[model samples]
Each structure stands twice: as C-alpha cells, then as structure tokens.
Target: MEAMPHDPAKPEFTPLDVPPGGLETPYGILYRPLASGLQILVLFAAFIGGPAFAWVIGQVPGDLSQTARDVLFVPMVAIFFLGYGLWIARLNAIAFHGIGLGLLKALFKLIVFRRKPESVADFIPSRDKLLEMMVRAQQAGSSFAPVGWLVGVIAGLTAMLFDSALHPAKLFLLVGGGCVIWAHLLAWLGRRNWLPFMESE
Candidate 1:
C-alpha cells in the first residue's frame, strides 16, 4: 500500500464502489502523507504534553479549596486540555457513533431499501458555507481537527455552567461531546477523494 496526494485545487469525492480507506492511519488503508510529522506530534503529546500537564496539576497549591481544584479539573481548563488530548489520543470514538452510524444508516437505507432518508442533511449540511469549510479541511490535513474540539468544549462548558453543579449526564457530554464535533469534520474528510488513499496492489 502507498499514500498518494491528490490535487486539492479541484476536489474529488470518494467513489463508493471500491473499498474506501480507513478513517485514520492505524487502520492501514490510508496513511498520513505527512505521517512523520503526525508521529512526532503524537510522541510530543504523549511524552511531553502528558507529563507536563500532570506535573503542572501536581504543583497546584495544596492549601487551595477543593472546589477550586474541582472547577479547574472538572468544568474549566481541564476540559480544553482534555478536548485536545482526546483527539490526539484517538480515544474519542464514542463521539463519532451517532453521526457516523447515522450517516451510514442513511446511505444504506437509501441504497438497500430504495427509500430516501431524511437524516442525511441532519448529519451534514445539504448545501451551505459549511460545505466550503469542509472542502478546505479536506486539503488542510488533519490539523483542522482542533476547530471541532474548541467549539465542542465551549458548547459543552456553557451547558455545564448554565445548569450549575456537575451531573453525570452533562459531564459525559462535556468530554464526549467535543469529540462528536471533531468527528464530523473527520467524517467529511474520510468520505472525500481529496485524501491520499492507500490501496493494496
């Protein structure tokens, strides 16, 4: 298998006939053309970012109130760090389940059942500037993923604060929700022919 870059100036959506590439590198069909750079970033996040974040947390003033630390780790700054870390760690699959499976279901329903599905537009915009943004992302490599992370964190945090007091469901949404937003962006890319799709000879 080999990774090949296509011209992003003119985008091509993937054809559904042959097997499509894996969403990410580890799955093995499509490789990161800039796999080396991403690998380095992963190493830095694991070795450098992970340990640094832990050390910084450890340095928090021992005399501070429990509530303060809780906010920092629970609903505030930690959420940003976590939102970022989740994407880096690729542990955010739970976020993609809804939209991912829903889109698949919609496609299957239309194809197999020979009935049009309404949920397709709900998962993605039928036509709008968002499509333009998604096209740009198709070319920009995976670096654009954080856009979803940032938005999801802000939305989740706002919900948590408005309700006040952490609830199990809200907290689940807090971390998990961010991944959902990011996953959509990934899905947009995964389906497109703009990627350097690796295929077996």
Candidate 2:
C-alpha cells in the first residue's frame, strides 16, 4: 500500500512528555520556582503599588496651571513607567519565560530604533560580565532581601509624603490611604498562600 502525504496545515504530534525537573535554558541555567516570601513581596509591590501610584496621578487636579501640571506629570509618568517595567522584568526573571525572549525584543530596538545606550541599559541587563555577577548572586543563595525591601518601602513612603505636602491640589489623604490599603492586601495575600515563586530567571 502507498502511504498518504501529511497535510502541511495540520499540526504535528509528538510522543514526548514534559519532564518534571527544573527548566533548563540555553545559557546553561536551570530556572526554578521562587520562595514563598519573595513571591508575595514581588507580586504585592507590582500589583498594589503600581496601580495605586497611577491612581494618585489620576487624582491630581487638572485645573493646575499648565507648567505646574507638566512639572508634576513628567516625574509621575517617569516613575510609573519605571516601576511597571521593573515589575515585568522581575516577574519574567522568576518565571523563566521572560528573560531571553525579552532580551531579544530589546536588542531589536537597540539595532533598529537607534535607542540610546543608557535607555537600553535600563531595560537590558548590563554587559555579559555584569550578567555573570547576577548569575553568581543567584547561585550562592544570597539575595538582597533584608535591607533592599526596607529601603524601597522607606523611599516610597518618603516620596509619598513629599508629593502630598508639595502638591496642594492633590488629595493627600486618598493617596496615603490607598498605599496602606495596597500594603494590607499584600500581607493578606501572602498569608493566604496565594503568592507565587519569584526567583530570578
């Protein structure tokens, strides 16, 4: 009997099954799930703080003079975008699904878009040497947990206080209270075992 040709549009099937072991990367790194505490903190900051800060900006009075509004909006937008980009990058690092692919996307911009080095550096990892340092930090089980989170929180609180006091048209109570609500949600989620692992990619 003659064999029939397979259709090109049809999908191919493989008998192979996915292994349960850690995921391996072409760079020879095996990405694994993150610790519970780390996951909670990561997600909490991204989901809660990200939106709250945006909300506060939205609440800023539009009636302010153009120059004043522009002055405030410029910094607010910069911080919002920076926080959002970092959040996604950190999530991908832990998830193993974001690093190489994300890097490739960034590289295209560098090549075709004529993006500046400093801007590229912000999105991409430093040089190969710096990436090596990051990998070493990951392998040694040493993380910046202790003071890193504390400093970030303190800095955020300080910024909030300054923004409230300086921007008379902004509703200080709403912004500050929203931050507290965001933090409370994070603690609640962490306690409920709803957080995911957040280790580096």
TM-score per candidate: 0.24, 0.27
lDDT of 1: 0.41
Report, for every candidate in turn, its global Cα lDDT versus the true structure. 0.41, 0.42
lDDT of 2 by residue, 64-90 (tens): 344433333333333333433443455
Q: Residue by residue across 1-201, what tens digits does model 1's lDDT show?
A: 877876544334553232344233222233223355664554344334323442343233344344433443343234334434543333223223424655677778778999776433545433332333333333333432555456556545644443335563564474346444444444344334232322222
Candidate 2: misplaced stretches above 4 Å?
A: 1-49, 60-170
Candidate 1 regions off by >4 Å? 1-38, 53-201
